[model samples]
Target: MNNINTRNLDLNLLVVFVTLWETQNVTRASERLALSQSAVSHALRRLRDRLSDELFVNGRGGLLPTPRAIELIGPVREALAQLDGALKGAAPFAPQYEQRKFRIAAGDIIEFLILPRLVAQIAHEAPNVIVEVLPYPQRNDISSLLENGEIDLIIGAPGPTSASLRQTPIISVPLLTLIWQKEGLTQERLPLNLYLERPHVMIEMHQRGENVIDDALRAQGLARRSGVLVQNFMAMPVIAEQTGYICNLPAQIAHVFAQTFNLSCHTPPLDFPAPELHAYWHNRFDTDQGLAWLLQKIRQSASGP
Candidate 1:
């Protein structure tokens, strides 16, 4: 194959090419690009002539990309993304000024525990920026979401690491025992056997059968009878209040709920380690000025001065 000429190649034509490739129809691409259908057709012809290849051919229902077109897609998209980043100036996350929406994937617990504070901070600082938080059903796929630009960030427990993802530790706090009224439980700390004997409320958000508490219990050959299963930490207080069920949750969140719902919190007797929470993102956005600024602000809020 002849190398395409670097000189006299219009960059704007590549934008049209990408739009047409994605939409696979001149009429649709024209509508999406706010250009006439004839204009889009003319641009495709020009691109074909420039590259000496019929990039797409009409198929059964839609335009199909030719082999050469398939080969060009990755490089073209990457080049355009680089060009866009350069032209857009420094910050990628300037929600105060930029009109881009940031998508975040996190568990319900993290949303309940941390988002209110983060949103308050964003409202005061980056009022124009919009945030969409989506639930991550499988924590293992979080790295894939960041790599594919599906999510800008993931806030959750310390997840398995990948080469493409970078992590920033926010805070690590011990787990506390959450119970309803302290009617029967007199001691501030209950023994491991007693804790396991009591009926407990479990929050199984990500994995169905596996839980951090279960793993800890298995280590000591002890198991707690799950009286109820709830999905979110926010529901734990309400459920425990009604059923007198005990729950183990992050100390920060447990304390917050305890104060609000007038629940009792105590140190668990088991030797369970504390959960470590971290924020992970694609390394590609590490140097982005706007994302960097937002991350710093989040860290400040999470860690305090």
Candidate 2:
């Protein structure tokens, strides 16, 4: 389209398009926007005419984006985010009573440590607020999600460096070796030989990839015997109890799991520094009061329990 034709387009149509793409249902998108279903449908029809494409089509369970939508979604979402941030100047956030929601992207490990405290505080203070936790996305989607304001915070490895992002360390604790007593291990601290010889039940977030411990082992030209591979830390206790495989986990959570299961926690025989977890957010939201409040809550969650 020419500049004149593009200038004739309504900005509200783009908002409707992004909402539909996110919700993937006309009814849900309309409800979210406080618009009647017919009004949302009409907006979509007008958008299709201006863009000259069937942006979405009926699909199983919900609407699916066509090729054009997938192509344009990124740019449209970014543009909307910039405008939304500019317009949200110095709005006061009332955690005590605001009916607001904050979505966070985090791994189960951090969720194990932080969610309990965060939820308790939310329930006590902000009865009407919602806290949604989503799994950490892959590399590229992390940047896209933060820029689009889809998530308020992300807790995991550092993402791509960008001027729009702000990040700070969350926590770091030594990794301890976890083992079932049936393994006949009696040293006050596990021996390096036993550590390397024992069959290891490992947590590899990326399938078949090395975790922090494995990476350190590789640096010394050593590796552990892999008996089983699981995805999350929550499952390791069960497998360790039934089998004699050794598992490694962060010290705090490892002790918690040790007391619950009949497993024992020992200082890891290897010498490597603990990896740091960090929280990331978009710089554009520096003045978003709700986000600022929630960030403080998260930091408090990490400081104690």
Candidate 3:
């Protein structure tokens, strides 16, 4: 990196390099930058001469970034975004008149717990805004998605490790029991023996790993029998409704399902600290007023009536 001198380097060429890396097609890069194909080629040439590296190479699908180009992308993107933000200045975010889209990566249970009120608030306030709620992805992962700006924000437990990332706790969740009313579950709370005796429906968000409750129970030298293992949160309550098996879940979500399935909600026998939900965003976007405003709305929705 120190080998290249910035004094002779044109920032426009870096822009072109980044665009070509993103679009992976010279023609599309030219279209996005509003430059002639030959001009874009000239910029690429300037980039190669300035950096003395073939930053990109043609592949079967499109242009593939070279190893050096891959190494340079994160810093380059951050520099460009910083420059853009500075030039735009700190304009106050006006939600009522703002027209923007936001993407949130969260799981089904969170969607059930948070989205309806959020959507309603946005509709009434930021009427021109659009919201896209994506199911928590398993393959590509949220860290890469948030870093690359594919996602605007995330609502889930901690995992991202990038230094440019920031997170804040958004929800305090207590564990509760969802049981069929006919199961003769205690109105106040289920006894520990009853909790262990009944077959339990366990939720495994990733379709792997032990049930989250298992860890807490294991520490106390106790464990419950999982009559079923399910992937999605919705299925857990439904199975409990039909099979008379008890399912333990966050209180917010359990009550909603109980209302829907004509089931009963009760306190779980064991005491566990509340699990938390967090909102994560890139540090680069900390200065984005529009995003800041949307984040406030999400926070209000999570903690609202």
Candidate 4:
């Protein structure tokens, strides 16, 4: 437990350390850092003295981080990243000229509804910015992904809840059950028993045991036999159409797919809850300018002004 408080740390030296660790060679690090090789070596020596460890050693014709260095890497990288983000926040957001990649973790339903519009906006506003949509593994890990900088933002319903996460409401849409128009499923209200009896398609984006939809159903003392269990919401409509299996999806997604596939959506017979789509990010990025700009863009796109 080194009491290495960053309050009085030299930020520039950390930058040098990162460069050396990345390049694994003092000469190459010096070239990349735009400093003399001796200066880079001196900085490494200073860092070693401060941390009381020979952080790196020569091996395989290059510098290799020692065991102690491996231990320090995570916290050091996180601190440097936070500092970098803070400094960038002080400047104006100029997306077009900035070359940066933003990775977002979102479900397929969100990608279907929000990504197209957001891409259009980015094309007009930030042509140089690259956007990558990553698959959301499970609801529980969303917070960890955002915290680790693996994903810039998460766009979906708030999973459980967390104090470390900051969620911004994008829109509230009534959940709807979708079925093929030709199935003769009338729009007239039906009883909960009828809805439960129908074959269902379930979207399970969490671990093996945790199913939010099933939990919701159990809360009301009802259970629907799932004919299909898929990881993505985008596949739900297709599966539903092929198998005549009903699915619970957000209204917007159902609307788009229904129009495309000539399906019909109806209000669920059960007292199902509406889905609240929100934009979530770790508190560490609450003040980041790039994240803020992107969040604003998403909010506006979701609102469709």
Candidate 5:
């Protein structure tokens, strides 16, 4: 093999060479590349000069690769494949074998609903991958955090999204009221008067001094009597267990807590909208193969098996 100086190489000429070799005709290769026939011919001549070999020769079959050209074809194809993969952000992302670490910001409920399944999936599929779950920021600074590479993804309710970020909804969790079953408040359907009269535990997703349930209640000229304000959904169940306060929680978490902690799940007396759970990432990672793979696993876990 000759030691050709890569600094003097025009990579576009190799594209032309590959196209011509595949098509076996200058006109066809030019059409494929959207270049003039003259440009294709010129690139071929340059390739021949650069390698000191007549890479192609006219024959009864329109064109044929020389022995030297045939020997070059495999390596040329491999190089182009690697270049394409690199340009498309498809390289260095073999999840089945690659060791990678991804950091995430998520609410406690999102973590509870998704992490166990996600962790199991990662262990089964990408054993070397590590997932770090950071507490969700209690403010509207996710865009800056994401841009600064503080976290790889954020799983939570949608808010004011940044223009350079993308959000993919992973799951929708309906609101439910959780209470201690032993209290006998759920023997019959709880009345709205009773619900509004009881003390409650509420989740503060952003620590913004406002809860979604409270906002909805305020819209109808009503409000819950909040006895406790917690930063995470996980704490609400434990607090409710010790007190008579009802906890308004996501249905998924409420049901899990009911089964695990001997609590009761009841439909909210007020019409409450389900909160959407979305996986958000910076737009720069939109084409990232590893993020794409991890997202696929999350979606599958959300959908169950």
Candidate 6:
């Protein structure tokens, strides 16, 4: 990095390099930048010369970023965003009229718990604002997604692990076992033996790792039988309603299912962890007025009526 001359480099060329990396096609990148194809090509040439590397290579799909360009992308985008925000000056953010979209990454359960309230609040306060809730990427990829501006925030379990990321706990949700009430098991607590014997509907959120309650049971030399496995929490209610399968889920979600479906929530006989649902974002947005305001709204929504 020290080999490159900062003083001699054209920042606009960096913008072109970043745009080309994003679009992967010279014509499309030129269109995005409102520049001629020849001009975009010239910018790429100057960027390559300045960096002493082939920043991109033409691939079958489009243009593929070289390893060096991939390394530079996060920092380059952050720099551009910071500069753009700074140029807006000391003017306060006016979400009521500031038309913009925010992209948030979250799991199915968190989406259920938060979005309806958040959207309602935004509609009343910032009618023009759009909220894009994307499925949470794998834990390892979250920080880069936030840094590169691919996602504005992440709401789920703690996985960022990086010191640079920021997380605030929204709520601590207790774990509960959900079973169809038609089974006539009106017990307030599920006995450990019955829990082990019942067929389970597993909610597989992570690519790998034991379910939280399963991990706890395993620690106590116990295990549950999984008759069905599904990716999202939304699948549990339908299957649990249709079959005799039991599922362990967050207490709040279980309560909602209990009210709507033929299901009942029971305390797990074994000790389980009460995991805190947290809102995560890149530290870069810590002071961004819009993001800060949105974060506050998320906290309020999580607290509930």
TM-scores, all models, native as reference? 0.65, 0.67, 0.68, 0.64, 0.73, 0.69
Decoy 1 TM-score against native: 0.65
lDDT of 5 at 251: 71
Model 3: how far is 279 from its true place, Å?
A: 0.8
lDDT of 5 by residue, 227-279 (tens): 88887778888888888788877776677787776678888887787777888
Please list the residue runs of candidate 5 whose C-alpha ends up more than 4 Å from where it truly belongs after superposition: 1-85, 88-93, 138-140, 186-188, 207-210, 259-262
Instruction: Specify the highest-lDDT model's number.
Output: 6
For residue 185, what is the lDDT in candidate 2? 70
How far in Å is the alpha carbon of 276 misplaced in model 2?
1.2
lDDT of 5: 0.83
- State the lDDT of candidate 6 residue by residue for 1-305, as single tens digits: 64976778788998998899889999999999999999999999888887888989989999999999999999999998898888876478897887989998887877777788999999999999999988878877888999888999888875536988998888777888888887787788987788899899987757332357877888888888988989898888789888888887787778888768788889998879887778888898777899999998898888785
For each candidate in the order shown, give its overall lDDT on alpha carbons. 0.78, 0.83, 0.82, 0.79, 0.83, 0.84
Tens digit per residue, CA lDDT, model 3, 204-302:
657222345777899999999989988778888888888889888888777778888878888878777677788888888888888887888888888
Tens digit of lDDT per residue, candidate 1, span 1-305? 77777778988789998998899888999999999999889989999999899999998878999999999999999999998998877654545676556787777766666677777888888887777888764766777789888888877777567888898887665789977655556688866676777788888755422366778888888789888887777787888777777888787678878777767788888767766677889998877676676677667666633
Ranking by TM-score: 5, 6, 3, 2, 1, 4
For model 2, what is the alpha-carbon lDDT of residue 36? 100
RMSD of 5: 5.3
**Model 1: C-alpha RMSD to truth?**
14.5
| Candidate number with the higher TM-score (1 or 5) | 5
In candidate 2, clashing pairs total 0
* Pairs of colliding residues, candidate 2: none
After superposing candidate 3 on the true structure, give the runs of residues whose Cα lies further than 4 Å from its correct spot.
1-90, 207-212
Candidate number of the best TM-score: 5
Summarize candidate 4's per-residue lDDT along 1-305 as a digit string, tens digits: 56776777777778887887899999899999889999998898888877888889989979988888888788889998887898766668788877788998777766777788998998899999988998765777877888999999877765566889898888666677787788776655545776777788888756322455667889877788788888877788888888888887877777878777666888777656666777788999987889998988888778764
